[model samples]
Target: MRHYDLVILGTGSGNMLLDEEFDHLRTAIVEPDRFGGTCLNRGCIPSKMFVITADAVEDARSAARLGVHAHVDPVEWKAVRDRIFNHIDPLHDSAVNYRREKGVDVYIDEGHFVAPKVLEVKGEQITADTFVVAVGSRPVVPGTPGLDSVNYHTSDTIMRIDELPASMVVIGGGFIAAEFSHVFSAFGTCVTILQRGPRLLTAEDEQVSARFTELAAQRNRVLLNATVTSVEPHGDGVSVTVACPDGTHVIEAASLLVCVGRRPNTDRLDAAAGGLELDEHGHIVTDSAYRTSVPGVWALGDAVNHFQLKHMANAESRLVRHNILHPEDVRTLTNRVTPHAVFTNPQIASVGLTEQEARRREMDYLVNVRNYAATAYGWALEDTTSFAKILASPADRTILGAHIIGPQAATLIQPLIQAMALGSTVDQVASGVLYIHPALTEVVEQALLAL
Candidate 1:
């Protein structure tokens, strides 16, 4: 049996566990696919790259409205797609090489939990004093009729298309669906989004989701509260049938893309063999310290079934690493107000409570709304979009929540996240020192003032 101090199940956050502090220990990193995992290769980086390019193209096309008379030349699909992959492909190699150089055993095969403290790597039993299962998640394709016969793309494979389809029909109205709708629409494709809910971004605050739905309707076709029946090939394209409250409708497009959601990659690990229990969603059950039911075994990231964002995954990984080493002072993942951002054109970022969430919890709160056009930078950019910066409180103005919409919404929401994480009051956030004038951050300052 091969032995090591640590046996990381997956490569994504697994690599992050290798700290200078752990240099004295022998480590084995097992990853079946490419090294950087989903985020670096297919999920976050590549998708954002496409989103940025789509944004630039859309802006150029809209410039004529401002009398700029600028025109965007045709997007070179091959060149653009290749450029993004070219930059990302190398990082995977570097990560693998760096670990090998550091004397860490890197297994490029699947690792399954065979026994409580044993892992089976490529049919070989390997034992470790401690283990971390960082196996991430993959896009979930709904089991719709005729889905197999037709060519459908998920978040993973959609970005690798040879060229943007002239028109596409997207399934689901979550973040992936909304973001990809914007990207394809901006690229001059006829985009249609079919949502299973009443609005897009169902996971976000209701107000934010409603506003996003309104804004998205301006750029593409959005069908909400619709249930998809099937997808079938029609000539060179495909047609989707959906059943709604009123009746069934047929929508035709050149391509069909599914962005419903993701499922944790725990099945392949045979977690049951390790005595680790999983929830209904197939995610491993873990305590705050990222520990499983069995001793010496832990799970983090998407496998834990908590927050699936990359930042959250990395944070959980760090916490797991510390707890495993110390074991004395175990830290919980609670109390940290996680922030999320959608890469749509104007972007949407939020942290802490939503307006409805605050009210539901029966917390007395204050809501504030702001417009991008009200700011100088907004005027310079001829902005017409609206954004709300909500500061909720329990009559004491403790700053329970903050949400932002419009340009750079993600960047503007960071300070609010810091405030929430630190339990800073609204007064503290408002009184905090901020640089003056000629900055987009002034929007945050203005919103805080309203609070």
Candidate 2:
């Protein structure tokens, strides 16, 4: 058995946990896939880059509405694909080189836990004094009949396709679905979204979800409360049969993108063999300090968190690194200001509790909603379909949560996140700060004021 002082089972954010402080100790990083993991190779970065192009194309098409006679040339799929991956693929190589140069053992294969604190990688037994399982998650394709026989793409493979589809049928209504649907639809694909849930982005505030669904329907065909019965190969693409309350119908598309959800990669690691406690969904169960049920073993990121966001995983990486070094002085991970955003058309962002959550908890709160049309910037953009909503504790006026769906929604929600993180009240946020006149941030100011 090869032994080391530390072993990190995955390289997503696990790769970020390494530094000079751990140079003295022998360490090993086992990554079955790419060195930089999902976000760098597939998820956030690449998707956003593609989304930017789509957004630009969309703006050019709608430039007439703004009285700007601009035209966009046809997008060469190969150029865009090569441009993004050419930049991204090198970073992964560089990361691997850097880690190896630092005297860290890099195993480019799957690592499975066969015993406590021990993993089997490429027929070699690796044992470490301490282990951090940051294996993350993978795209989960629903178990629909004949799905395996059809050619389909997940978020991982969709962005890297050589050619854009003439039409796409997206399955799911979550962030992945919303973002990809926007990307393809704006890029001129006849996009159709089939969602089992009643609304897209069910995690957001109800009002925001409703508005987003309504707006999304305007751009593409959105079938809510619909479930897929089967997926099979059609002429050159695929056919999807969806069952709704009324009846069943077949939708054909040149491409199918499944964005239903993601499941923790714990199963890939065989964490149970290591005697680690896992939740019902197979995610490692950790305490506030990110310590697993077994001592000397830790897990973080999507392996333990419900928010499968890159920023959240990065935050946990910093905390886990510190806790690993100073086990005696372990600090609890705090997600009090956890915020996430969906990079779709009329982008959405949120921090803290939703209205449904607050009501479920039976908290006495006041809800305030301000449409983008109410702001001067909104008028400039001629945005008639976006808004921001704020929920606050009525007694102290402290903001409980904030949700936004509009241009620059992600950037606009940052100040509100700062307020909630620092315990700033609604009154403080609305009156204390200077919201630039006729700026998009005025929408935030108005929402807070309404609260």
Q: lDDT (CA) for every model shown?
A: 0.85, 0.91
How much lDDT does candidate 1 score?
Answer: 0.85
Residue 244 displacement (Å), model 2 = 1.7
The CA lDDT at 171 in model 2 is: 95
lDDT tens readout by residue for model 1, 83-137: 9999999888898899889989999988887788888887899999898998999
TM-score of 2: 0.98
Output the number of the TM-score-best candidate. 2
TM-score for all models, in order of appearance: 0.96, 0.98
Candidate 1: regions farther than 4 A off: none
Name the weakest run of 10 consecutive residues (lDDT summed) in model 2: 327-336
Q: Which stretches of candidate 2 lie over 4 Å from their true place?
A: none
